[model samples]
Every structure is written in C-alpha cells, then in structure tokens.
Target: MGLYDIIFYLFAIITIASAVVVVNSKNIVHAAFSMLLTFFGVSGIYVLLGADFLAVVQIMVYVGGILILLLFGVMLTNKIVSVDIRSGSIQVIPAIIALGAFAAILFSIMTSTNWKSESFEIPTTTSVELGNLLMSQYVLIFELLAILLLVAMIGAASIARRDKE
Candidate 1:
C-alpha cells in the first residue's frame, strides 16, 4: 500500500529468491554469486529498518570481504571447474515439514501479537556515537580484538610459509 512497504517487500523477495538459488545451484561459483545478491538484499532491508551501521557492515563485511574471499577461494582451487557440486536433496520431506511448522509458528505469532504504531526519531548517523563509545568506553576491548586478529593473521601467514618450504 505504501512506498516503504513496497520496497521492503521487494528486498525481501530478492533475498528469498537469491537464497533459494544459493541453496539449489549446482555450480559452486553460481551459488557464491547468488549469496552475494542475498547479502545485498539483506543490506537493503537493514537500510529500510533505519539501521545504517548494520547495512554498511552487511555490505562491507559480508559482500565485500567474505564474498570476495569465498569467490577467490573457489576460483583458485584446482579442478573446481570440473567438479559436479550437486547437493542431493536427501531430507526434502523432513525439510518441507520443518518449513511448514516454522511458517505456522510465525503466522501464529504475527496474528496473536497486538501491534502498535509509534512515531520516534531514528538517528541519522550512529557511527560518530559508536566511535566515541569504542574509543572511550570500550577502548581496551577493541584494542584486544585488534591484537587477536593480528595474531591470527600472523599465525596463518606462518603456516602458509611453512607449507611452502
């Protein structure tokens, strides 16, 4: 009925369709690309929900970093092009049953809940406040996380180097 609702539905449809493609595609490469579209659709939904930080993180971390890494790993692997990567649907009946159960649960919840509409201002930018909090309140934790990632990177590089020797 509204433009926002239309856009939300559009993104939701795109996400669901792309997720199905990712699951059902025989080719690993195609599945990975479909996963990229799924990530983009999720990011679009985040934007619509006024979670700008999460939207950016979804694009940057998932689409940019993880998807690219997955694509590179798939491309660089030997003999992947010749591989049949078709996943058999061994649990189709069980999966459908579970899906139906989950849908019923969601429908019941939606129908039972008394929904209220409230008007509130959503922040235009959360990054500045988040940055200040990280710098001031959570600085130690942030620094520790940085150190942990650095250590992991160094360990991975060392292992790769040793493998080459």
Candidate 2:
C-alpha cells in the first residue's frame, strides 16, 4: 500500500529466502554467503523500524565481523571444502508439521490482537545517546569486556602457536 510497507516486505522476503538457502544449501561456502544476505536483510529491516543504531550494529557485527570470520574459517579448512557435508537424514514431515502449527498459532495471535497505529517521534540518532550512557554509566562493564576479549585473543594465539610446535 505504501513505500515503507513495500520496502519492509522486500526485506522480509530477502531475509526469509536467504535464511532458507543458508539452512538447505549443501555447500558450506554458499550457506555462509546466503547468511550474509540474511544479515543484510535483517539490518535493512532494522533501518525501516527506525532503529539506526541496531541496523549499523547488525551490519558491522554480523556482516563485517562474524560473516567474514566464518568465510575465512571455511576457506582455510581443507577438509570442509572437499566433503559433501550433507546431513545424514532429512526430517521433512516433522518440519512441515511444526511449521503448520507455528503458522496456526501466529494466525490466531494476529487475529486476536487489537491493532493500533499511533504516531510517535523516532529519534534521529541513537548512537549519541548510547555512547553517552556507555561512557557515563556502563564504562566499567565496557572496559571489562574489552579486557576479556583481549585476553581471549591472547589465549587463542598462544594455543595456535603451541599447536604449530
């Protein structure tokens, strides 16, 4: 009906289709690439929802960081690319039944709810507010997390080095 609605549906379709590809693809590399598209779709949806900070975080953390790491790991592993890597069995009937039940529950909930459309001011920028809060109130926790990640990296490097010897 509207541009926003069209964009939202597009993102939703992309997310769902890519997620299905990620689940069903036999090749791990293709699955990872599909997952990248799924992440991008989710970030687009977040942007449509007026959550700019979350959208950026989704892109940066999932696409920029995690997806790249996953792709690199898959590429670096010699045995994974050579193998078929398909699951031993498929449970199509059970999956279909579960999907039907979930759809029914969702339809019931949607029908039962009294939907209201109200306009509210969406913040133009959330990063500034978040940064202020993190620096002022949650600085200690943030610093601790950084330290923990640093230690983890050091430990991982040491383990890798020991394995080489």
Candidate 3:
C-alpha cells in the first residue's frame, strides 16, 4: 500500500490499543500514561487529516498539560495505588449485545451519510484566525476561559499543598 496508508494504520492501531489500555489498566499511573498515548495518537490522526493546528493543540493541551495535571492529581490525592476496584459484572451477554447494536447503528449511519468536501476552503493561519475571533467575535468568552483555567490551576495547587495549620 501507500506510505500514508501504512502510517494511518499504524497510528490507528496504536490509538485503539492505547485506548483499551487506558480503560483496562489496573495501575493508575500507567493508565494515565496510556491515556496520554491515546491522546497523542488522535492528534497524529488529526495531522494526517491535514488539520495541523488542531493536532498541535490536541497534543499540547490534552497530552502535555491536562494529562500531566490529571496524573499529578491521581498521584497526589490517592493514598493507595493499585486496588482491585469492582467496576462491572462478569456477565458478557448484555455488554456484547449492546456493543453489537451500537456497531450496527454506527455502520448504517456511516453507509448512509455521503460526506461532501468543499471546493474552495478559506485557508488562513489558525492562530491568527483564532486570535482575530477571540478579539472581535468572542472576546468575553476568551477572557472567561482564561479566568477559568487560572482558577483551576490555583485551586489544584492549594489542594495539593500540605496544610500549614
């Protein structure tokens, strides 16, 4: 096959594998690491789709920033590391039936939907376009988001710190 096809399949396999690991892994830290890999694989897929800005942002925010914070939170907050948490039942019949029905619905939707590509897409620098939109059309939203992140960071820091009293 072609080079792109090979790369796509490799990334797709890693993505699915990491996702399964993220859900199935017993070790909390290892599960977090697997989740980061899954996020990175998805970003690689975005890059393969020619959405470079989205890919970069996904890697930076989801993998680099959010995942680190989540990992740290797990390590700092939890007293115990590996525990056998009873999540679900051993009955596989219901789960298999649900998965089969969902798959059928998704397959039918995919077969019926004919996706169309735009002939002339306006190509603009994503950062510049985002900045322009943030300043003009969505200034308040941008400011609010910045404030929210700041608040979250401060709150997390406070929670993680040892109490002086």
For residues 21-137, what per-residue lDDT tens digits would candidate 3 score against the true structure? 887676777888899889988998987776778889999889888899887777656665545432333656887799889999999999899978675553544667777888999
- Looking at model 1, report the run of 10 residues with the lowest lDDT sum: 78-87
* Model 2 Cα lDDT, one tens digit per residue, 71-153: 88776664665576443338978998999999999999999999897978887998898899899999999999999999999
Model 3: lowest-lDDT 10 consecutive positions = 80-89
Q: Model-by-model lDDT, in order?
A: 0.88, 0.88, 0.82
Rank by TM-score (best first):
1, 2, 3
lDDT of 2: 0.88
TM-score of each: 0.78, 0.77, 0.72
lDDT of 1 at 51: 84
**Clashing residue pairs found in predicted model 3:** none
